[model samples]
Target: MTAMSPTPHDPLGAVLPPSPDNELDTLRELVSSTYLNHDPSLVTIRAGALFARLKALNRAANHATRAHKQATADSRQEMDHTYLGLQNLLYEKRHLEREIDKCRQFASVYQDIPVHALEDFMQIAPEEAPLNSPNAKGAPQLDLKRKELIKEKEALLKESKAQLATVENVKTHIDNLMKTATDVRRKVNDLVQPLPTTSEPGQSTPAS
Candidate 1:
């Protein structure tokens, strides 16, 4: 009967001198068992899941940004409509002022006429002359159309004001989403950066 030599092994990943053949076999079994104990594809699957989630989040952020841009475009269109209102209002106001001037000018002419002349003008009946004269029939309709235009300008101004408010609200929401997305991306970067890269066991870079 022969006594066998005691086998020695390094436990702390220490460099070793020549090891006995039995010890090498034991070390190989230890490595194989450890590898078998954990799932081989778990790391890759988890990394893929993380990337997919980030991609989805980025797409949502892009959509949000587009929606915000659309809101801006809507606001600009509304501003143009407001300018149209203002321009039309100014034009009508000027036209009304001119019409008032014409009315006053005609009234002054009547004032210059003697009272008997005014009485003489009143006695002339249009029906006996021609009531539906080309110029006479259209004045009231023209005045009504101008009044309607003024009212439309006012309504458009009010609508523009409401659109302005909606634009502001959309801008605020977009700002908040951008900030939140930035934070989320930063967190994802931190999580991904610490993952180990494939390399030889002793080939680690020194801590920076």
Candidate 2:
């Protein structure tokens, strides 16, 4: 007899030691001897007993295989969910940073009203305002300039208020996102925790 050669992909050819082709032949012969050909009742009884035991073992193996597949699928789904959560957090973080930059730029542009300058304008007479001013014959022009400055100051103050409101809104949104992320992390941790195993009602621990 010649030994089979191993394939390149499987150097051992077989993962485990080979089994005897007639391993169960001895057991079959024992059963046949115990239930002789003349006794049909005994043969039926032995055959039924053997079939029931094999059927139970097969059922258990099938159930275990199904459970293993389900567990693998559940783990994959959890990983996908966690990845999606991280993506959302990254998007929110970037958005928050961009909003912070806008807030900083707006803050730099904001200024307090020029109250002292307005007071100086108020002290000047309506007609002789420019007569005593450096730009002599430009009293009307000076008055117009004062009015323009007052309007511009009011506009600047309005814009500053709007910017503050926007900053507050951005801050609120960022806080909400942070809270959501924390909640998701807590939920994932809780879900990932293993449940305690309990013994079956009729089972007992093995003695050491």
State every prediction's TM-score relative to the real structure: 0.35, 0.38
Top candidate, metric TM-score:
2
Off by over 4 Å in 2: 1-44, 107-208
Query: Which 10 consecutive positions of candidate 1 have the poorest summed lDDT?
Result: 9-18
Best by lDDT: 2
Instruction: Tell me the number of clashing residue pairs for each predicted model.
Output: 0, 0
Tens-digit lDDT track of model 1 for 117-197: 323433675457554577446646755665666587566556655555554554565455455545544433332332122
Q: What local distance difference test score does each model get?
A: 0.45, 0.50
* Residue 112 CA displacement from its true place in model 1, Å: 3.7
Candidate 2 Cα deviation (angstroms), residue 182: 13
| lDDT minimum window of 10 residues, candidate 2 | 12-21
Candidate 2: tens digits of C-alpha lDDT, residues 1-208: 1122454322222222222223234337646665465577765675566555544444544444454345445645665665566566567656656755664565422245332344455576486455455655465665676677678867766766665666566566656655655654554444344322323222456999
